[model samples]
Target: MTDLLFQAFIAAGGTAGFCIIFRVPLREIPICAIIGAAGWILYNVVLLTGDDNKVFATFLAAALVGLLSEIAARIFKEPTTLFTVPGVLSLVPGFHIFKAMEAVMDNNMDSSESWVTITFKLAAAIALGLLAIGAIFNAAHAIFNKTKHVTTDMMGTLKNMTTPPGKK
Candidate 1:
């Protein structure tokens, strides 16, 4: 849809602007922009597909961002945060914060409290999503390195056994 594409374009532009402000290298800006756009698109798609749970949608989008950021980091040899921080900027619940403040200004404590609660839930979802992906990646990396080291050590031992005492 045109609206979705427009929103994605806005998301990408916002991400690129943030990256520029934070001094992210120009060469990496496009990648960050694309990641941010993809996350926003996923969030919108989740919302459009029957289940309108904002929190769940946000969590899913955050997870996608984390996964993509991790992959981009590995492929581009950059820090994961470089891709993640800007990518997540668009997903932040800024509107909820604004609404909470507006409610407080109107002496509507209950409304303000609800909005605050919603904001916290959304924030927590984002954190948990990123944390889950980071943990998974770290565990996999550790296992892979361990396997590689063991294999390398076995190869060395085998070489020593066949080298006839290094031909000394």
Candidate 2:
């Protein structure tokens, strides 16, 4: 329990730091930080579970983080990409990709295979992350718009829409 809490704090602090450095809104900082922390926790859980499929675990965690970030953005009425991008930084799989490339460069076949596996995992994670975020955001937008009220046009025409038909 303590370990988990500590991990969460680290993840949140790192995410909040990124937001501050990037000049993200103060109001959105806590949301992004929590999202990052959740992603890290999920990642650690998968690692500790002794699952052989690290790739799948990584991808799932990233996708989840992305989706949550999008949700936070919508809730806060901010740019979805802005929140999601920073929140997912902790799960970007950069080290895996680097190790894969290093293995190839060193001409070690065994190391190369291990690195290749990691590379694939990282690639899958990124791809799934982007896909999940895009799908969730799109779906949420649709649903929210459908449930929102309509508006009027300049010529007194009834503009039946959920949002204001402009970027927020």
* Local accuracy by lDDT, each model: 0.91, 0.80
Model 1, span 23-107: residue lDDT tens: 9999999999999999999999999999679999899999999999999999999999999999998999999989988998999
RMSD of each: 6.6, 5.2
- Work out the TM-score per prediction: 0.85, 0.74
Where does candidate 1 stray beyond 4 Å? 147-168
Which residue pairs of candidate 2 clash?
Answer: none
TM-score of 1: 0.85
Best by lDDT: 1
Report the poorest 10 consecutive residues by lDDT, candidate 1. Answer: 158-167
Which lDDT value does model 2 have at 24? 86
Clashing pairs in 1: none
Q: Which structure among the candidates has the greatest TM-score?
A: 1
Positional deviation of residue 139's Cα in model 2 after best superposition, in angstroms: 3.7
Task: Write candidate 2's Cα lDDT for 1-168 as tens digits.
Answer: 799899999989988989998998887888889888988898888888886766777777788787886677667777777877778887776787788788889988899898888777677776787687688778877797576455678987767753456676
